[model samples]
Target: MDAFAIQRQLTGIEPLNGSNYTTWRTSVDIMLGFLDYEFVLYEEKPAAITEESSEAVKLLYAKWTKANTIAIRLIRASIGETIRGDIPVFNTAKALQYYYLTQFMSTSYDGSGSVREHIYKICKLVNGLRE
Candidate 1:
């Protein structure tokens, strides 16, 4: 594929709801590949650079997705008052991944965490809000 087309396809360059599954999946593939490339870059930099970047990215994703869920829940909390409508994507797993990626991937582009630490830090950002 052409570089321009590939670039457009990878970072999830369009609105989610309007995209076809083929486009979305291809975009996701592109995104993951991009993330992997970033990780490689980090590995090539100063030794600690890779680890720190990885940690930041992973934790950021955890926090971001949880917060996204919280955000939607908050919106739902206002249902019948501030917002009203069946959220078309709420019940799907892919929706959750999209939430995680869209919110956190920019930060997590490097992938340095030990997994456990990322969870604790990011999940903590969700706070105690019920939504």
Candidate 2:
């Protein structure tokens, strides 16, 4: 996911960056909150891994990705439901395209062809706009 790359990049800080590790953690929490929960007030649960657990860092990244994926699904469901209610508004090709555009740029990636096409169209439009 592009967000995986972005989230990883955001937290990749050198110790000399004047921002502490805690700050990066908080940033991640904030982003996660925006993607899912309204606020992030919860007990910090220690990962229940055995001593034989391998690749702790990879596991942690997977967990983070999973959490974000759930959030994306919830958001998509909500948005799709909301948009579907506009059957009256969706009576025309322009309206359908407009709605698709709205849902498109905001959609989360799930490795679907439709999603890839949406990304490609958005990128094409964005490039055109930029030029």
C-alpha RMSD for every candidate: 17.5, 17.3
Global lDDT of each candidate: 0.39, 0.42
**lDDT per residue (tens digit) for residues 53-80 in model 1:** 7877666555445544443443233233
Q: Candidate 1: where are CA atoms >4 Å away?
A: 1-53, 81-87, 91-131
Q: State TM-scores per candidate.
A: 0.26, 0.24
Off by over 4 Å in 2: 1-54, 80-131
> Residue 82 of model 2: what lDDT?
32
Clashes of each: 6, 0
Q: Encode model 2's per-residue lDDT on 1-131: one tens digit a residue.
A: 37786466444422212123345335544544555532212323235566666787558645654554554333233232333243234322123334555655675667667876666546533422221
Query: What TM value does model 2 have?
Result: 0.24
Deviation in Å, model 1, residue 40 alpha carbon: 27
For candidate 1, what is the lDDT?
0.39
